[model samples]
Target: MNERIEDKVHFTQYISVPSPTSSGRSAAWLAKNWHLLNHLVELEATTLSVSARIEESIRGRMLNVVVHLCNVEDDTDFTELVLLSLSSELVKIQSISADYIEREVRCNLRGRRVTSDENDEILKEIMDALEKRGVRIDYS
Candidate 1:
């Protein structure tokens, strides 16, 4: 069967890292650190500015780090390096995962759509880093 493949476009992904109760750090505190943000920029992982927003839910204050990847191709590498850099800061990382929207678009009979999968290598590295620090990773 002959089929045409559609090019996949990379969208913005959101990664949430919950604050640790023991660390006594608030979302604002972490956001102001700027160490991780600066490091990522230096490595050229992302040209997009990194912003940390604090959300107040029933669970309390949550730190959500938004990483804007300049190139979708660098998603995996960017994520891996960010997590690693954050680890060295002794920041308590609760979970690391991407938030993206999935939509279905109509295609011609000869066209097929392909989407990018989560960066497994980076995910694994983040998992290991979290585990070593006794932090929990959000796989869900």
Candidate 2:
């Protein structure tokens, strides 16, 4: 038998609190704010632009994005990561276990061109949504 090696990238996960994680509530928030899509944002150097959208999927939906890394220089990027629906069993898991929790709803983690902003706008949006529901989250 051969041991399988997983291909991974350098990234972080969302860790929330209050005893058992309320992944269901968190996922609901994501679906509610999903309409914040179809946007064009430029990179720091003004040399790139990112186009993000939400596309329908069988498993739920995915964050579809594309980046013209060059603006004229190179081209690049969106990301996926399922956002398990509220009705799904995975959504009931705790938030701290990044791997165990149902990621049916998650922000784009793949940092392709790397935004120029000091803080990620998408993450901020998510945080705001959770705040409304009285859910506190920390990314680690």
Cα lDDT listed for each candidate: 0.34, 0.34
Candidate 1 at 55: error in angstroms? 25
Candidate 2: give the clashing pairs: 65-78, 67-77, 70-73, 70-74, 82-104, 83-104, 83-105, 84-104, 84-105
Candidate 2 — which residues are off by over 4 angstroms? Answer: 1-44, 47-88, 96-111, 116-119, 129-140
lDDT string, candidate 2, 44-117, tens digits: 23333333232334564322222112343444332333222222222224332323221422333345444534
Overlapping backbone residue pairs in candidate 2 total 9
For candidate 1, write residues 47-139 as lDDT tens digits: 221222222234433322222222455544332112222332233533433221011111110131112232333333334544554554454
State model 2's lDDT. Answer: 0.34
Over 4 Å off, model 1 = 1-80, 83-118
